[model samples]
Target: MATSTEHLIDIDRYTGELIQGWERIKQSIFVILTTRLRTRLMRLWWGSKFNEMQDKPGNEEVLMSSMMAAISAINTYEPEFKVTRVVIEDMGPDGEITITVEGIDLVDEALRRLKTTI
Candidate 1:
């Protein structure tokens, strides 16, 4: 069985539930995308990381461009996913960001659409 972060097990909330298949992979990608650069303890607290694009931007175009570049860079040598596209929408009024990730699972070759709100 897969263990630790590599297994896509939900570490928050102590659910003891493992995210399976494509969902697991999707969550992994989400975590990677959300983690601030140089914040993880594993790299002696010095890991090169991607910005989460959460900082309030002056314009939508600026936010979209930052997110796209960071999210796409995650497709590098990772075998878990082959990201086809990433769409980030700013939900008005509620002030939430919706991230839509489209990708193919490399292990089973299944297409996935994952939506995350932050």
Candidate 2:
């Protein structure tokens, strides 16, 4: 397994210290999924367009498109994480969506999963 020394965006809750490795990768995935594309001026191409699917009909086509956008964004922006699959579940009538990302951690060569609601 490779080593990571990068500091976490937020300090660890119990330890009050920086996180690294897989936890950092999870944090990165969360940021990429939630950030809207082109919103960050410097990193215009850094985020996924998946958020655009919000409020739209959650048909197969839209879900597929969102999935592709998410994979593309992660592939383009973060190289350490290799996405294996992305699953999006539409919560009916609640306007909430859950996204699950499964991938390999290039740094450690281990499978990793991240789930978030948007």
What overall lDDT goes with each candidate model?
Answer: 0.60, 0.78
Q: How accurate is candidate 2 locally (lDDT)?
A: 0.78
Number of clashing residue pairs in every model?
Answer: 1, 0
Summarize candidate 1's per-residue lDDT along 12-106 as a digit string, tens digits: 32465655666567656666666666676675343113344455563777666656654555575245777788777564445566767787776
Error of 1 at 106 (Å): 0.7
Using lDDT as the measure, which candidate wins?
Answer: 2
Lowest lDDT sum, 10 consecutive residues, model 2, at 1-10
Task: Give the distance in Å from residue 8's predicted Cα in candidate 2 to where it truly belongs.
Answer: 9.1
- Worst-scoring 10-residue span by lDDT in model 1: 1-10
Query: Which residue runs does candidate 1 get wrong by more than 4 Å?
Result: 1-13, 44-52, 58-60, 91-95
Query: Which pairs in model 1 have colliding backbones?
Result: 37-49
- In candidate 2, stretches whose alpha carbon ends up further than 4 angstroms from where it belongs are 1-17
